[model samples]
Each structure stands twice: as structure tokens, then as C-alpha cells.
Target: MTVLQWTATLVGLSFALYIGIAIWSRARSTSEFYVAGKGVHPLANGMATAADWMSAASFISMAGIISFLGYDGSVYLMGWTGGYVLLALLLAPYLRKFGAFTVPDFVGERYYSQTARVVAVICAIFVSFTYVAGQMRGVGIVFSRFLEIDIALGVVIGMGIVFFYAVLGGMKGITYTQVAQYCVLIFAYTVPAIFLSMLITGIPIPQIGLGAAEQETGTFLLDRLNGLHEELGFAAYTDGTKSMLDVLAITAALMVGTAGLPHVIIRFYTVPRVRDARISVGWALVFIALLYTAAPAVAVFARTNLLNTVTDAPYAEMPDWFTKWEATGLISFEDHNGDGLIQYVGADAVDGTGQPVRNELTIDRDIMVLANPEIARLPNWVVGLVAAGGLAAALSTAAGLLLVLSAAISHDLLKRNWRPDISEKGELIAARVSAGVAVIVAGYLGINPPGFVAEVVAFAFGLAAASFFPVIILGIFSKRLNREGAIAGMLSGITLTAAYIVYFKFVNPAANVAENWWFGISPEGIGALGMTVNFAVAGIVSRFTPVPAGKEGRDPAEVRELVERIRVPRGSGEAHEVSG
Candidate 1:
């Protein structure tokens, strides 16, 4: 079959499977809708968590970013993986033991204030929306290319798929569907890596192939890539352009933000026991490692392949893949010198004839991974598989984030705060309705995204770091932290981070360069600063404020006891189920 036919078959089959699963595992109560009835097996939950955690950013954009940015992209690899470690070690078990349906639930109960819950709810919704926008856009990109449709229409179709499962079955359906998605995405991701590795390096294992010598050139793969980069006036593949301080700040923000993401944190709440939560974390790390370890190799393979095929090539003689992508407007070339040869070079670059000329190519970074197989002349079926994988990765995360948004609005805002007497059935309906609305909003954002998939996702992580990480950490570890401090910290941290990002990204795009950044920290890394501000403000305010002595909050002694209990692990008892 042709590539288009293969893509439609694979994508249609996957969507059908997802819809079937949703019908089979439809949530009957709020418990099932919110946390899969708190009965998921560790291994299944691990796969589901991996699928949810590895969004479109991880599957489609991470390798793409690394391909273009070279060594500067290591921040994403380090920060995101390290952040999962932080979540598993420092946050997961405690939050799971707290028996809450959502992050805001923990904050509301721990801080003993509806006000804190409301703030957390708002933060969760905002961060989730920001993150989901990237996923939806990724879906649009894949559909626009493989399905041969407009990106806006692709996003609408994707929204319909997510709405069916996410609204119908909630966490229960999303969890199982994510498990299937994990299998599809991992298979799709690895198969191409193996093929590229063998084609380029004569090694089937991508991890080892990345360091091996090229089949034709005999030089090391990275060294060859570096030579190509320098020959084209680009930075060396191994040498990064970002300063050490900025790298440190970006890494820290992503790490903290990963631990604080509402969608990821909520995964732990689906298990049957606290030990199962920890076990699921371990299992998730193992599953996540499969793709993470292959991403760098994929980046190297895709980058080397792209530069060789495109640079100084004839536009009329370009491959079929080039024209397909060009039609989508993600790749374009202009004849600056009227020579008809593609001048795909960096600034101040000289052509093959040794004449200095302007760069005449514009390629979107997000296209690297999607176009990799075609660039390497891989099989049509493999290309189709990747299209399916990209959709799976994007839709799985979109479903998870939408669930977080819906739960924040329905459970935290309505059931807990505004309508304490709301019935469980009413809350469930509201949750489904909210998810439907969120799908429409997410589709619109996808049609008009703020930036590329990875950049938008990084901004969302910054928001989560600024708003949620400190408060959640303090709520778990500090007994004296009251509603005032928690509320103050969240509001101040997120506000500062949001305003800085908006000013740089939207308000003053011309001044977004490093010279204009405060303390040389870019908007992406500013979340670390915001997190520090949160910690500082919470600490200072908690010190001068009156301690809770059973007056307007939980008893001071009880709060301390609660902290100690969460710190110490209990036996493998049944999971504590929170009432609706």
C-alpha cells in the first residue's frame, strides 16, 4: 500500500481501538472517573504513566529540538528525566498516601483553606491548558502531513477522538488507552531508530550506533555531523551556545515542574496501595527509558541525514518527501541568487562554489522527526507507523491534561468549594461537560499555537514549577505552612513567571534575546527564579505569621503528626480511598 493508505489504516485502527476501550471501561462513578477506582495494577499504571508523561513534546519534538539545537538541547533530556526521578522519590508516595483525587485536593486539605484550593485549581487548569495546546498542535501537524488535510481540520478531528474517550471513560478509559498508546508509540519510535542505525552505522542498536563510525565515511557519527555543521557555518554538534547558568536554571525548572505537573502526579493516585505507587514509579522509569535512551541517537541520525540531503542541493531535483513537507509550508526555499540551487545554510555561509550568500531556506524544527524516515528512505509502512506513534503520543497526553483541567473545575472548584452539597452524579456530569469545553478550547489553541510544540510545552513546565512545586513540597514537608503562606507563594510565583513569559514571548518579541533577559536567564529558565521566590516568600511569611493552634486550621500538633505519618511508610495495606 502507499504511505497515505498505510497511515490511514494504522491511524484508523488505533482510533477504533481507543474508542472500543473507552466503551468497555467507561467510568461508573466519580472514583473510577477520577482515579480508575484506585485499583490499577502497578505494571499497567506504569505503562499508562509513561504514555501520559511522554507527551507530543517527548515523542515528536524532543528529538527534533535536539536535532537542530545540538548540545544545547541536553537541558531537555536531563531536566525531564531528572524531574521524573524527583517526582518518584520525593513526591509520589506522599501524595498517593494522602488519598486525594487531585493536587488541589491535597493543597486544600493540607492548608485547611478553600482559598488555597481555589488558587491551586486555577493554576492546574492554566498549566494543563498550556501543555495540552502543544499536544493538540502536534496532532494537527501529523494529520496535516499524513492525512493530507489542513492543520485546523486535523486538530478538530483529534479533538473529537480525545473527547470521546476522555469524556466518556475518564481516567479508567484513558489509562488503558494510554497503555495501548505506549506500546504503539514505543514500537513506532524504536523501529525507525533501529533502521536508521543500521543504514548509517551498520549497527542495529541505536544507542551504540550513535557512537559508532559511519558505514560510508568511516568517521565517528557525531564527528561527521560536527564537520558538516562547521562546513555549513553552524555551531559544532558537541559544542552548545547556551551559558552554563542558563542551562542550570532551565534544567532545575523542568525537574521541579515535572514533579509538580497535575497530570503526572494524578497517575500515582490510581494505584491500589502506596507501595504500588512506588512500584509503578519504578516501572514507569523502566518503560520511559526505552524511548529516552533512543532519542539522542534518533536526533543524530535525523540531523546527519537532513543536512546531507538538503544543503546545496537542487530545488527541482529535491525528493518527494521535500515537496510533501513544502506543501504543508513547514519547509520552504527561496532563490536569493536566482541560481535555482537550494541555499540551505546558516548566517554568513558560503555556497559549494565558495561564495558568501544569504541563507535561503526556512524549515520548521518540528518537522525533523516526522520527516526522518522519509529522508533516510525507510519503508512506507515505517513512515505510516511513525504517523500513528506521533498521534498516540499527542492524544494520550492531551487526554491526561484535559482530565486534569476537568477535575480541577468540577471536583475542586464546584464540588469542594462552590457547591459543597453537590451530588456525585452531578459532579461527574459537570466533569464530562468541562472536558468537552476544554477540548474545544484546546483545539482552538492548536489551530493558533503560541509557538512550536516543545517551546510551548517548556513554558507550561515553567508555569507548573512557579506555581505548584514549592507549595506541594512545603505542604508535604512543613508543619507550620499555613493557608496564607501557601496562597501567597503560589500567587506571587506564578504571576511573576507568567508576566515575564508574556512580556518576552508576546508583548516584546523583539527584546527576547539574552541581553534583555533579567540576570541573563531566558524566559524558559526564569521558572527556577520563580520557584526560589515561592520558597522564600512561603518561608518568610510562615515565620512571622501565627502558627495554627486549632484555630482556623488543622491543629498544629495534628499537622506535625500528619507530616510525620506521610514521611514514614506504612505496610502494604490497602490503599486509602478518598470519599467523593
Candidate 2:
């Protein structure tokens, strides 16, 4: 069969399998809808968590950015994976012990205020929407490239699939589906990487192959990459230009944000035991690290392979990969001096006489991973496998995010706080309806994206860091923190971070520079500043305010009980009743 036909077959079969699971495990109650009846096993939950966490940014754009950013890209690697450590150590087990349906449920109940719950619902929706848009865009890209379909149509196809499982079976459907997705995505990601690593270095392991001697040149792989960069007047693959402090801020923000994201946090609440929550985090990290470690190796291989193929070559002799990417407008060439040869270099590169050199090649960083198999001249099946993997990465995360959105609207907002008399069947119906609405909204945004996939996803992390991380941590560890403090911290942090990103990214694009940035930190790194502000505001506000009291004046006692329950770890409490 043809490559496109094979891709269609695999993607179709995968979709059918997921849908069948959704039908078989359709949610019967609000409990099944919201937290999967809190019955998920640790190993299974870990696989689902891994699928939920590794979005399109992880599977597709990360390697591409690493190829161009060199050492600077370590921020993504360090920030994302490192955050799992914080989740395991600080947040996951405790949240599980709380036995809540969602993050807002914990925030609202812990603070003893419906006001706090409402605010958390807003933040959850905002962050989830921001994150899911990127996933939908990834779905569009995969479809557009592999199936020769329009991006809009691809998003619709992705939306239809997600709506089927998420709306029909809620968390129960998404959990099992994500496990299948993890298997598909991980296999797809590793297989091409293994093949390319073997081809480039004659070594089976990508991480070791990245540093070993190239089979043909007998020179270290990194050394050859460096030589190519120098010859082309580009930054060395081992070096970068971002300042250390900026890197630190970005990495720190991503770590905290990854730990605090509502979708990932909700995964902990699905497990029946607190210990499972703790161990599941470790397993999820192991799954994530598999792809995280391999990404840089793939980046190195693609960069080195492209340079070797294109440098000093005639325009007419360009490889098929070049032509294909060029068609996507992700790669372009201009022969300014009328020479048929392409010269790709940094604008700062110059001749000995101080005359600036013009780079003829323009390549988008996002195409690196997608074009890897083609660049290596691998089989069409490998390319098809990569397509399936990218879709799995995108669709799995999108489904998880939509489920959270539905939980926030149907569980947290409607049933728990606003309309407390809603019946179980009614709430279940609301979950499906909300998921459907979210899918449609996400599809629209995907067709008209706010930014590149990875960049938009970074905004989600920044929002999570600013709004959720500080308050949630303080709620668990600091017994004196009050409702007013949590509210103030969340509002202040989210406001400042959102305003900065909007101003720099949209209002005055030219002002987005190191010289003009606050503390030399770009908008991408501003979450660190926001997080610090949250910590300070909450501390100061709590010190000045009275301890929160419920209508019956028992909030302080309730808070004490909450702290004790989460800490004891022996008896994780019952999952919240899903019926309003």
C-alpha cells in the first residue's frame, strides 16, 4: 500500500479502537465522569498521565526548537522533566489524599469559600483552553502534511474524535484512550529516532549515538555538527546566546507550571490510593524522560543530516525533503546573487572585509521533527509512523484538557457551587454538553491560532505557574494562609503575567527585547516573576487578614482537618460524591 494509504489505515484503526473503548466504558454516573470513580491503578494512571502531559509541544516542536536553539533549548528539557520531580515530591500524593474531583474543588473546599472556587474555575478554564489550542493546531499540521488535507478540515477531524470519547465516557473514556495513545505515540517517537541514530552513528541508542563518532567521517557526531555550523556561519550546535539568568527563570517557571497544571494535577485525584499517586508520578516521569532524552538526539541528527545534504549544493539538486518542506512554506530559499547554490547562515556572519553575508535559506524550527525520516531517507512507513505519533501526542493531550474543562464547568461551577440541586443524570449530561462546546471552541482557535504551537503552550504554563502553583502549595503546607490571601495571590499573579504577555506579544511587538524586558526576563520567563509575586502577596495578605471562617464559623477547624488528612497518608479519603 502507498504511504498515505498506510497512514490513513493506522490512524483510522487507532481512532476506531479508542471509540470502541469509549462506547464500552460509557460513564454511568457523575463519579465516573469526573474522576473515573477513583478506581484507576497506578501503572495505568501513570501511562495516561504521561500521555496527558506530553502535548504537541513535547512531541513535535521541542526537537525543532532544540535544533535551532542549541544549548538554550535545555530550558525546555530541564523545565518540563524537572517539574515532574516537584509534582511527585510536593503535590501529587497530598492532592490525592484530599480526594477531590478537580483542582478547583480542592481550592474552594480548602479555603472554605465558594468565591475561591469560582476564581479557580476561571483559571482552570483559561489555562486549559490556552493549552488545548496548541494541541488542535498540531492535529491540523499532521493532517495537512500527511493526508494532503486543509488545516481546518484536519482540526474538525481531530475535534470529532475527541468529542466522541470525551463526551461519551468523560474521564473513564479518556483514561483508557490515553493509555492506548501513550503506546502509539511512544513507539512512533522512538522507532524513527532509533533508525536515524543507527544510520548516523552506527549505534542503536540515540543518546549515545549523538556523541559518538559518525560512521563515515570517524569524527564525533557533535564535532561534525559543530563544523557544519561554522562552515555555514551559524552558532555552534553545542553553544547558545541566551543569558544564564533568563534561562534559569524560564526553566524554573516551566518546572513549577508543569507541576501545577490542572490536567496533570487532576490525574493524581483519579488514583484510589495516596501511595499510588506518589509512585504514579515517578512512572509518568520515566515515560516522559524517554521522549525528552531522545528529542535532542533527533534534533542533532536532523541538523547534521540537512547541512551535509544541502550545503554548497546546486538548487536543482535539492533533496526531496527540502522540496516537501519548502512546499509547506516552512523552508524557503533566495539566490540573491543569482548563484544557484544555497548559503544558510546567521545574519551576523560576515566576510573578512566586514561586509554582511546574506543567508539564502530560511527554515522554520517546527519542521525538524516532522521532516526527520524524510531527511534520513527512511521508509515511507517510518514517516507514516511519525505522523501517527504526532497525532497521538496531540489528540491525547487535547482529550485530557477538554475533560478538565468539562469538569470545571459541569462539576466545579454548575453542580458544586452555582446550581447545587442538579441531579446526577443532569450533571452527566452537562459534562457531555460542555465537552462538546469546548471541542468546537478549540477547533475554531486551532484554525486561527494565536501563535506557534510551542509558544502558545508556554502561555498556558505561565498562567498555571502564576495562578495555581503558589496558592495550591500554600494551602497544603501553610496552615495560617487565609481565603483572602489565596484570592489576592491568584488574581495578582494571573493579572500581571497575562498583561505582560499581551502587551509585549501583541501591543508592541518591537518592545519584546532583552533591553526593554523586566529584569531582562522575556514574557516567556515572566511566570517566575508572577510566581514570586503570588508568594509575597499571599504571605502578606494572610498575615494581615483573619483566618477564613465558613458560615457556621468552623473554617479554621476544617483547615486543620484538611492538613491532617493529607499528611497522614494511611487513609486517603473517599472521592467526592459527583452528584450535586
Worst 10 residues of 1 by lDDT: 549-558
- The prediction achieving the highest lDDT against the true structure is 1
lDDT of 1: 0.92
lDDT of 2 at 26: 82
Q: Residue-wise lDDT of candidate 1 within 203-247, one digit each (tens)? A: 999999999999998999999999998888888989999988899
TM-scores, all candidates, are 0.98, 0.96
In model 2, pairs of residues that clash are none
Candidate 1 segments whose C-alpha is farther than 4 A from its true place: 351-355, 550-557, 575-580
Model 2, 331-427: lDDT tens digits are 8999987889987777567777878889888887777888888888899888888899899999999999999999999988898767788988998
How close to the true structure is residue 353 of candidate 1, measured as C-alpha lDDT? 88
